[model samples]
Target: MDIKEKIRNFIESNLIVFEDEAVFTDDDNIFQMGFVNSLFAMKLLGYIEQEFGITVANEDLDIANFSTLNSIVRLIGKHKQEV
Candidate 1:
């Protein structure tokens, strides 16, 4: 699957919302919407690093980087380029 799809699937799997209730676009802030908890951010960080073979540095641990699907994708893209 593509990067967005992979990240989408991972986010969906961890969602606090039911399948029917889980409605979000790539630009939506899942964290602000309460779709996931703060702990999920750590899981997402690990997933992004391992799945994409990119390391997330200490300076890149901003919540804004992981708040939305689009943001997460952008963060991954940035790190992938660094790799």
Candidate 2:
């Protein structure tokens, strides 16, 4: 699957949404929506690094980069380009 699809799947798999039809857009703020927590961020960081084969710099640990699907994709794209 592509990067966006992979990220979406990973997010969905970890979400504990109460509504069966709950949906999130690429720009949605997952943290604000209560779909995930801070701990999830660490897991996401590890996943992004391992899955994309790029290291997340200490300076790149900003929550804004991982707060949404689109942002996460952009962050990975940035790191991949760096490699």
Candidate 3:
């Protein structure tokens, strides 16, 4: 699968509530949907760095960049471009 698909699958698999799997969409706000907590955010960061081989900078830790699958994908793209 492509990066976005990979991310979507990863997020879907790691959702806070298992039954809400199908409820997540690319544009959906994960935090607003109560999908992310502090611990989960760090887990997501680790996943992004490990899966994409790109480190997320401190300044880039803004929740906006991680609020949705689409945003995360865009953030990864931005990081990749910078690399």
TM-score of each: 0.96, 0.94, 0.89
Model 1's lDDT to the true fold? 0.93
TM-score ranking from best candidate downward:
1, 2, 3
**Candidate 1 lDDT, tens digit per residue, 43-70?**
9999998999999989989999999999
lDDT ranking, best first:
1, 2, 3
Q: Who wins the lDDT comparison?
A: 1
lDDT of 2 by residue, 8-79 (tens): 999998886765644889999999999989999999999999999999999889999999999999999999
Model 2 root-mean-square deviation: 1.1
Candidate 1: segments with Cα more than 4 A from true spot? none
Clashes of 1: 0
lDDT of 3 by residue, 1-83 (tens): 89999988777777777664558778999888887666778888999999999999999999899889999999999999999
Which residue pairs overlap in candidate 2's backbone? none
Best by TM-score: 1
In model 1, what lDDT does residue 18 have?
87
Measured by TM-score, how close is model 1 to the native structure? 0.96
Find the 10 residues in a row with the least total lDDT in model 3: 13-22
